[model samples]
Structure formats: structure tokens, C-alpha cells
Target: MPTTARVVVLEGDFGVCAIQELELPDPGPHQAVLEIYAAGIEHGQLQQVEEPQPLPVIPGREGTARVLEVGSEVTRCKVDDVVLITPWSADPGREPELPLVEFDDGTETEVAPAGSWGTNLILDEQFVVPIPNLMDKEGASVLGNTTLFAASAVRTAGVGEGDSAAVFGCAGVGLSTIAAAAAAGAGTIIAVARDDERLEAATASGATETLNLSSAAAVERIAELVPGGVDHLFDCVYEFETASRPGRTPVRDGGSALVVGLPGTEERQDDLDA
Candidate 1:
């Protein structure tokens, strides 16, 4: 059975998008049809526009939605269930009926991952997280991508119970990392950022402590608090300008520092050399 879905399309480069309607066809046996409530924009959405790709991409990567329908054999959710949509598709091996959407102009073409429209799209159950019905839709939407990235980083860093960890940046990924670390039962979670608002967000996200880098020697302050240094450090601001900073050095001798973030390369060599 086919259903109507609304989507925001970016006909060309830039983040600007236009809303349109599409006819969604029957979902795969393991898929569910999602009616989006809210979607969050990610950095990759903007960056991808510059790379070569087909035009008219659906721009949302993650979002909050309600299950309008489910295909046979789908057990994770049922109609009317609130959920979060993540870009990770657990089963991409199966040939999708998608790219199945027909544009309003009566044209049809393939849509890439960028076309993983949360506004209204058929999604795999594995990519959907069942959320509390009472949870704020906007917050749940933003958390999808953040949690996805944070979870992987935390897992890769091997954070453990009672371990001390510090996260720098305190924005989307940073805040989410703090939350993920806390969820992993980290003993002390330190959040370092330049803004008060972000630091506050980090605390709410589960940071046991917070620091504003502009006010003090962040590394020194962190070392003083953790004594032997934190067990792990997530340097979210690992860019050219801040690359050589001691932000990543506050880890203990055997501890790990996970450096992340996009950066310009021209000055990276010179800065790291200093």
C-alpha cells in the first residue's frame, strides 16, 4: 500500500530546502512508515552539499516521528508509537523499494542517504528507537544524531564504570558524549567549553563537573581535580587552532585521548610542530 509523505528537498547546494509531497510505497517487511514531527540539521548536511551528488536530496539525518504504519514482521513498533529516527540502517543489504518516492512534478529518481527523509519516510525498525510518549519531540529529534555519534565514540574509547572522563566542546557531540559516558557509569565526567550555556547543557547531559576554558588553565584545573588525570579524554575541539593545546594531555599514562572534529590542514602541521 502506498501513502502520502511530506519532505523538505534541497534542490541544489546550501542548506536551504523546499517542502514537497511524495507518494510512499509499501515498506519492506522489516520496515515501518514514519511521520516526522521534528528534525535536526547536522554539520554533514551542509558539508555534503559541496561534494558531487544528485540534486533534490532530502536533508534531514535524524528526527522525531510517530509510527503511522508498520510492515508485516515488524515487531519493534506499532502505529502511533513515538520514535527517534537515526541514519544507521541495520539492514541495507536488502534492496529497498525506496528511491520509491514520486516527486510532485511527477518525476522519480534515486535518493541517497541524504534522502533519508525523516519528514516522512519509510524507515527500518533497527534505525528507530522507541521513545517515551511524553518526551519532548524537539529534544528527542536532536538527540538522535548526537547520541549516534557519541555512542560510537564512547564505545571506541572503551569508557568503563568508575572511570574518569573529560569531554571538550560541550556542544552537540560533546554534550552527547558526556551523557553517554555518564550512562556508562563513569565516576567523574568533566565538561570543558567556552560558553556558560553549553557548560550548563553538559551538566544536564550528565557531566559531573564543568569548566570554561577561557577562565583558567583548563588542563591544569583538570589535572588538579582528577589527581592522576582522567582515565579518558574526548577532545571535541581538536582543530588546527586548538590542536596543540594540552587539552588531550590530561589523560593518565595509560589512559586514552580521543581527538575529534573537522579542521583546516594548512596550519595543522605548523601548529602540531610547535
Candidate 2:
């Protein structure tokens, strides 16, 4: 008999999930069994639901977990240590070995690389990162995903002191990008959103100016504010027509416009500008 874990399983329909009991897998020589404390839902996982992938899928990509069991060769953490669970493997060059979810009757569903959204998960030692227990589990989980994404975008774009930056969409990740830019000494930061509430949130996150997409011409407004154009444009919203086109308009020639968000629907190659 193995330990039972509750997993969120998505069967035929898209965006629908059901709770089911599954038998936890034993840790492999280089793996650890983790008891997840807090999990964050990533947009990539949600996007997968609509695309063609195996059904009865488990959809969490990042989380905070407590190590419960380790294999003979595992040296990452002890039984009670807390760790961060990332979808990407510790070794990027190799394909990840995913654990199967076993049902009561001994039937098993083979899940690919992504870990389950469940109470217990068996993962490779490299996927579990030991962290200081100072921050709450919820906040730590967020830091691994959304905040990490924002930081990566800012650093990759080489946004420096006194550079004009604009963020299109003030959701969680968007707000995080705004804060990161301000912390890096950005000169003028413009936050664009479809509503006032998001704009207000962006302001609180250190945005110097806010624009409501529905109320005015976003590209023109941003150009007026930035003069020549913005140095960096980060788009985190996914509209059907403007997956990220509108935000790209404000970037100066040769400037970077990073699409940090996931698209709701895929567009044909012909529809996009070169």
C-alpha cells in the first residue's frame, strides 16, 4: 500500500478540473517525495487546457513543498526541509522523468514532465530547491513564478537608470515588472490597462503614469509621454486581436517589447507583423 494524494485532474473538457485520489509514487534514487504546502497556477498550464494534450492532466507548474521522503542517492534536502517546486528541471539539457498517478485499482495515468496539482508530489531532486523559511509559503510560491518572470524580463531587456519603460496590463506579473523597473531606477514608467483599478494598482507598484486602454489611443498617448519612444515595453495582457501588438507600438526602434503573458488564442502567422 502506498500513500494517497489528492490530485486535481482535468479529464475531457477544457478548463474543468476534478479532485481525485491517487497513489503516490515512491522516490527514485535521485528524487524526493514532497508534501506541497502552497501552489501557484501559471498561465502556461491554463493555456495547455485548450491545446491538445493528454486528458486527466495535472496543471500546476510552481509551488512550495516540504520534503517527506528522499531516495538513497538524494542529498538535496532532509525529510522536513522546505523547498520550491519548479516546472523546469534542475538540469535543463535533460528531459525530466515524471511520476505517474496511480489509481485505487492499480491503473496508472502517465503524465509528462509537468508535476501534478496535488497534496503530494514525487519529483526529481533537482526540481526541489531548498529555501530559507522566512517568507510565507504563498508569497514564496509567487516569487518562484510571476516575480521571477518580471525580474528576468527587466534584466534581459537591459533596462537601466533613467530609461523610459511601459507595462501593458497591470495584473500580478505586470505590477511586479513595474516595481522591478522602479527599483532599478527607471526614469518614467507608464502603466497601461483597460480599467482604472489596474492602473491604480500599477501606481502603487511605482508607475509614474497610468493609461486606460479603452479611454484613449494607447500608442499615441505613450508616444506623447515618452517623446521618441519607450526604452522597454512589457506586455502582460492577452486580448484576442491584440495579443501583444498594441504594447509593442510604444517601444523605440530597436527597443525591446517583451510579451511576458500567455495568449488566450493562437493567431495565424499571416496575421502577425514581421
Candidate 3:
């Protein structure tokens, strides 16, 4: 008898189902079987789905695993290979061998590839990134996602050496933005958050200064710290709309404000005489 795998299943009725006992499939010419090590939880899961997530869906988006088998034509991975699977929604311009993973949690039963919170996952060769031996697994997992966001934000802001930058929000991505900004040589970094604990962590992480946004003057205070106003600002706060406003108003006339936060919306660009 072949081994059976337990996985989560999602129904179209806004419900999650847990299903078990799946028969494993043999690797395709470009596929491999992976034993999941760990997976990261992201806020994207909270987004409302219209089509009702595919039934018997596996909902994890990011995970680390070890390969157990490979397809006849697959050259990317072999048994025992540690890999981090991050399937991009866009054509990442890399390769297409990797299949996008989705989880369905509607039903109470489990299913394969419908959820990756379980032990085993079958993936394509192009979807796997080799885990480096020297890198810490726990740290690299978070860094992988953060680095991608940082790269895009940094590039969008045209951040470079000597540019004064301020980052609003002290969460993972915010902290990553701070690090990237500092590495890019932003002379000053002001990290903004609502509490003292996270603010302190932001400072320790790389923020030149930290401020609490619980009060109304948080934006004004940050401007006072960066007298000339920041040249660039990165907003990573999803709920706080004001975070972006301060950086937008306080920054120099020619400065740029980059909003990387979520809950996508359309806002008219502030009209300022350049």
C-alpha cells in the first residue's frame, strides 16, 4: 500500500475542510516531491476571495522543504535537497517549471497541494530555490520575502547613498525597508509605529530614530527630527492612512513618497507646484 498524506481542503462556501489520506503521485518529468520543513504565515491570507478559494485547497504560500524524489527529466533537485518554495503570482521572468501552490480550507477534510501546512509537497524544478548550508533556516525564510519587498521599494524610491529616508511602520517589511534604506546609504532613517516596544525594536534594527504614532503629532515630530525633511519615505502600515500623509507633506518639494503598504486603494496624487 502506498503512503497517504493528510492535507487541508477549502470549500467554495467560505469554509475550510480538513481532508486526509491522499495517495502520492509519481514525479513528472520536471517535478519533485518535497518534505515540508516549515512555512511562513502572511497577511495575504485574510484577503477576501470572490470565487471561493478552490475546494480542497492547500492555503500556504511560502515554505521550506527537503526533496525526496525527482522526475526523469528534472535536473534542478534530487533526494534530500533542502529547498524554499516561493511561487510568484507574476511571471517572475525566471522559469515556469514550478507549479503555483494554493490551499483550500473550506471542507473539514484534508487534500494534497490544496494546503501546504502539512508534511509533504510536490513541486516543479523551477519553483525551488536551493537552501544554502551556511544560512540560518529560521532567518532566511523571513528574509526571502522581505528582501523581495525591499528590493522593489528601494528601486521605486530611487534610494541611494546620502538620501535621507524615513520608513513608517516597524513590522517585518518595515524593518526590512529600514535595513535596505540604511544599506543604500540613506543618511537618516526615522521609523514610525504606534507603540514603544516595536519602536525600540525598529531602532535596534536600523532606524536612526523612532516615534510613536499613537499621538496626533507623530508626523510633525518625525519632520522635526529630519530638519531638511526626508528625501524618501516608505510606508508599510496597512491600517494607518496618516503614516503616508506625514511623509508626503513633511518631505522636501522634490522628495518621493513610496507606499508599499496594502489594502489597495486609489488616491489622487497631491497637487503641489514643483
What residue runs in model 3 are displaced by over 4 Å at the alpha carbon? 1-4, 48-51, 72-78, 89-91, 94-115, 241-249, 264-274
Per-candidate TM-scores read 0.83, 0.83, 0.75
The TM-score of predicted model 1 comes to 0.83
Worst 10 residues of 2 by lDDT: 264-273
* Candidate 2 backbone overlaps, count: 0
The sequence of per-residue lDDT tens digits that candidate 3 reaches over residues 1-274 is 1224565444456554466445556666777787777766655433422236545455665677778888888776677877776653233464444334333322343222313456777766766677775666655655435556665798788888888887877877888888888888877888888879988888887788887888778788867877877888787764566444544547877888877645343342232111
Q: Which scores greater on lDDT, model 2 or model 3?
A: 2
Q: In lDDT terms, which candidate is top? A: 2
lDDT by residue (61-172, candidate 2, tens digit) is 7789888888888877878898888765567775555677665445577665446478988887767778987769877876566776787789888889999998878888
What lDDT score belongs to each candidate, Candidate 1 first? 0.75, 0.76, 0.65
**In candidate 1, which residue ranges exceed 4 Å CA deviation?**
48-52, 90-98, 104-107, 113-119, 240-248, 260-274
* Residue pairs in candidate 2 whose N, alpha carbon or C atoms collide under 3 angstroms: none
| Ranking according to lDDT, highest score first | 2, 1, 3
**When superposed on Cα atoms, how far off is each prediction in RMSD?**
3.2, 3.1, 5.0
* lDDT winner between candidates 1 and 3: 1
Q: Of 2 and 3, which scores higher on TM-score? A: 2
Q: Compared with the true structure, what per-residue lDDT tens digits does model 1 show for residues 1-274?
A: 7877777777666555678877777777877888888887766555655555666677767888899889898888999999888766656685544445666666676654424454577876877888999999987887777677788789889999999998878878888899899999999998988899999999899999988878657667888899988899886765523633544456788887775545336565455456
